[model samples]
Target: MKAERRTQWLRGVLDLCILGVLYDGEYYGYAISQRLEQAGLGHIKGGTLYPLLARLEEMSLVTSRWTVRQQGPGRKYYVLTEQGRRVFEEQASDWTMFAEHVATLIYRRGE
Candidate 1:
């Protein structure tokens, strides 16, 4: 799909998407973006991601720290806070239920 179309598809879900990604483990901005791209979420960009990271940090749902690695450059990594983990659990449940409902609708739409 085109980048613009993909961007439209991901508009309102960017925050949750980022949270879900961070749930996997801590990651810096570039690595996070790269992972999303690798996962076929190429539309997600720094413009959309950094602001959400800032907001999540402001809400105390995530914490960040700088990590220096010998293999590459030092980067600021983000991880979910305890509160974030709890929220992730709740949001994941909600997303699961919502997705099932939407899937059913899509599957039965022509019936």
Candidate 2:
């Protein structure tokens, strides 16, 4: 079956998902983008991601550090702050509950 289109609300939910991934480890923009795509969020755009990263940094949810590698140019790496970890925990709990409820609604609607 074809995949369903994601709504704006789902995109907002994905911001939390993205943050959750970064909470696991530090990652650069391309790596984060690739990770999200691997997790089945190919619809996300750089436009959205850059703004989200900036917002996260502004909110103290994440911090970025620039690094230069011998093989390539410098890149800004992002990692979750202590506050981000706590926020991730809270958001994960909330997402799980909301998703379960939404799943039930969808299943019932289909039935």
Best by TM-score: 2
Error of 1 at 62 (Å): 0.7
CA lDDT of 63 in candidate 2? 96
* Residue pairs that clash (backbone atoms under 3 angstroms), model 2: none
Candidate 2 per-residue lDDT, tens place, 1-111, comes to 234546456566866977888988999988998988788767567788888899899999999999989997999999999999999999999989998999998889746
> lDDT tens digits, residues 1-111, model 1?
787777777776667778888999999998888888888777456887888899999999999999878997889999999999899889889888988998998899668
Tell me the TM-score of model 1. 0.85
Residue 102 miss distance in model 1 (angstroms): 1.1
Q: In model 1, which runs have C-alpha deviations exceeding 4 angstroms?
A: 2-5, 69-73
Candidate 2 stretches greater than 4 Å from native: 1-4, 7-9, 109-111
Clashing pairs in 1: none
Worst 10 residues of 2 by lDDT: 1-10
